[model samples]
Target: MSPQVALRKAFSAFPTGVVAVCALVDERPVGMAVNSFTSISLDPPLVAVSVARTSSTWPTLATRGRLGMSVLGSEHEVLCRRLSARAVDRFEDAQWHATDDGAVLIDDAALWLECEVRSTFDGGDHEIVLMEVHEAETFPDVTPLVFHQSQFRELHADR
Candidate 1:
């Protein structure tokens, strides 16, 4: 197998939670579906998300650092899938609230984080974005949404 194949296989072994980072660009809300998001440092309230260099949304995201990160709930699979597609109106049926900067706070997310870009590192295939968490809040009821092996899956406790 080639490097790409091997990399994909290895990455697939690790499950991750899903999130959508949405921000305002030209007075419009743009959202990117991401799985490569994590908490990097707790002391400084920092988080990170990787974005592909070739992504069409990269240019717009690069122009702004203040963004909203919405952690999807287990019931949000349809919304997640809609945002991942290249189709029109990613937010057509979805309900969202506007932030001060005009980005969206997705309805019914498990958590919503408002952040500012702290720095970025050029990773080979993706740009690693380090964000400073300015503010954050969690929904009253939250069951996490997870992704594994290029498919949506959730965890359950075994007795």
Candidate 2:
């Protein structure tokens, strides 16, 4: 296998949750899929989501100032896939609400974060977006969508 294939295979074993990083540009929604999200700090309520520099959405979102991060629930695999596509009407047939900061908060998302873009840095093939949370909303019933081995999955705890 090629190095590219091997690299993908290696990382595929690491399960990750799907999230939509959305922002408003000229009153329009611009967002993308990210599995590279993590909590960096609790004291300041900070988070980080990395996006590919090549992603067209990055240019619009990074410059928009304010943004939202929505964690997709298990049944939202279709939404996750929709947002990841190259060119499509992402908001089509999707239900969402707007945040004060101008982020289009998707309905039924596991968690929604209204954040301000704090910083951006080059991360090889991606650009890391470090955001400061200004407000947050979370759901109580939805389970997060997980990605593993290049596929979507759900986990069951053995208790």
Clashing pairs in 1: none
Q: Give the clash count for each candidate.
A: 0, 0
Estimate, for each residue in 38-94, the C-alpha lDDT of model 2 and write its tens digit. Answer: 989988999998888788887777776568889988888888888999879887777
Candidate 2: lDDT of 107? Answer: 80
Q: What lDDT tens digits, residue by residue, belong to model 1 across residues 1-159?
A: 999999998999899989988888778888878999999998899999999887887678667767888998887788888778886787778878768865567888889998888899999989999999988999857877899988898767687
TM-score, every prediction:
0.91, 0.93
Residue pairs with clashing backbones, model 2: none
RMSD of each: 1.6, 1.4
Measured with C-alpha atoms, the lDDT of residue 102 in candidate 1 is 57
Q: CA lDDT of each candidate?
A: 0.85, 0.85
